[model samples]
Target: MRLKQGSLLWYLYLDKSYCLLSVRNVKALVEYFHLLDVHGKNTLNDVLFYHFLHHVTDLKKRQINLVFDMLDWSAVGEIGFEQFYVLVCILLAHQNHLEEQFMYRHSRTVFDLLDLKGDLRIGPKNFEMYRFLFNIQKQELKDLFRDFDITGDHRLNYQEFKLYTIVRINKLQKRQKKTEENAERERSLCSRKCRIK
Candidate 1:
């Protein structure tokens, strides 16, 4: 799969990491490494690496510095393939672990925003107040509320709301994956035709 610009693969590339060698395209990886090796030294200095982290990721300054230190294992202000590979593995694992926590906390935040009354449940009245926040019609909102209110209580508790949001996100992700697959297929066919010509 061709990694998107903001995906984890791109981050690894930005770090000039070799950890992605097993999973990413060789040509793309080589191009990315060359892009980061600005001084033609075949290595990333502190300044260049900092610029990479600053531009490619939204990580905080502390986190960026931590990653930089991790990659510069020898404290010589330069990183090699082994350091990059290890950093990539650590970052990927950390991100995967945080994803679930982030999703759960985000769902709670959304549910709290929707449940304005502090009643631990989102009823039609509270849901109506947030209608302007959504693009769906009133009827659609009602139907959604009904579907989310799994216990037939005419209200959605935090758990029900969280589940509903997760399901919705999963559905959207599936659709996005299907679209991306179709686009990749089209690109492959075009490339084949070009080669034939």
Candidate 2:
């Protein structure tokens, strides 16, 4: 996946090399990935991956299969630690509603998974359809395109999409915080007062 230094993909696979994280943490992650290589083939087959996904994420059977197929970019029945690690990042980011943040930073991997066509660019509709992979509904996608299509060409290349994801995620977080604040206010005794027309 190009493996550029300091990139998200690079961080996932080579943070140990760079010594960017704790040595113990890196060892733990490496050991976990190795342990999943139950047959010692240095690759994970469907069974191992299925159990991994089943425990960590809410993906249905069909969705899990689809994810496996995509990660099996070689069309082989097994995938190495690099592929497995990419899936791990995807699942964690998705569970936290951070798809855009992860995708924007790891555009190459994200584009490979979601480009749908080999066209090197994507429209908001693509986001709408495939965002379900992250278990996210169609929130503000079209509006994002309309608002952030800075080139005015109605499609997002990697850089533009990165900017879009950052903005969209920031807005989502803001909305979530606002919702939490409003809920807190609603539960407060002083909030018993209501306005009447």
Candidate 3:
């Protein structure tokens, strides 16, 4: 539940080639769309959508609604193949540990998703509802707002959001690097101990 920086926990839980989908991936997704279309409506209602989300992700249930909301743009209570495809892509990206990259690539979409009320911008209030989706803590989000809200109006425009994504990606990379370095040190120490024995 905590967003551990070194793992997928940092982002809304999901994977990566999955990120760079080949045509075959798209074809398989089309088949999946058909399989999930139990009502033959070529759309997924909240029920079907929730089921699909549960099928792919390991718990952390609430984040699903935010994602579902992102896809259910028309507020029609149903989503079509396109939206479903995007959701799957997001899942794949997260699963492959490519969330930072995915966010960077799809910043606008993410910004729109965060701007829950169709507002031109996003602020802490909007983020509070979807915070579980990113799993950020109160202090971290406060830091984010303090640093990124360039206009000091307590909201983020698309450009500001884009900058935030870049900064987030950098922080993730740094954390991953530090984790790798620590693992290498552990391995090196273990080898030395083994050789000494």
Candidate 1 — worst ten consecutive residues by lDDT sum?
Answer: 12-21
For model 3, the run of ten residues with the poorest summed lDDT: 1-10
Best by lDDT: 3
Candidate 2 weakest lDDT stretch, 10 residues: 1-10
Q: Tens-digit lDDT track for model 1 on 1-197?
A: 01236754555422222223355544554566678888887778877877766665566566566556545645688886555544444344234332222333356654665565567898887666544323335986677787888889899888887886677657656876999999999999999999999
Question: Against the unseen true structure, what C-alpha lDDT does each candidate score?
Answer: 0.59, 0.66, 0.74
Q: What is the lDDT of candidate 1?
A: 0.59
| Residues 151-178, model 2: lDDT tens digits | 8888777777777667766877798799
Residue-by-residue lDDT tens digits, candidate 3, 1-197: 22234432223333342245657667767777888899999999988888776665654557667667777888999999988867666655655557677777788877887777787799898877766545567997899899999988999899888998899888988998999999999999999999999
Give the Å error, residue 155, model 2: 5.9
Best by TM-score: 3
How many pairs of residues collide in each model?
0, 0, 8
Q: Model 3, stretches more than 4 Å misplaced?
A: 1-18, 55-66, 185-197
Cα-lDDT of candidate 3:
0.74
RMSD of each: 14.3, 8.9, 5.4
Q: How far is candidate 2 from the true structure (C-alpha RMSD, Å)?
A: 8.9
Misplaced by over 4 Å in model 2 are 1-23, 123-129, 144-156, 170-197
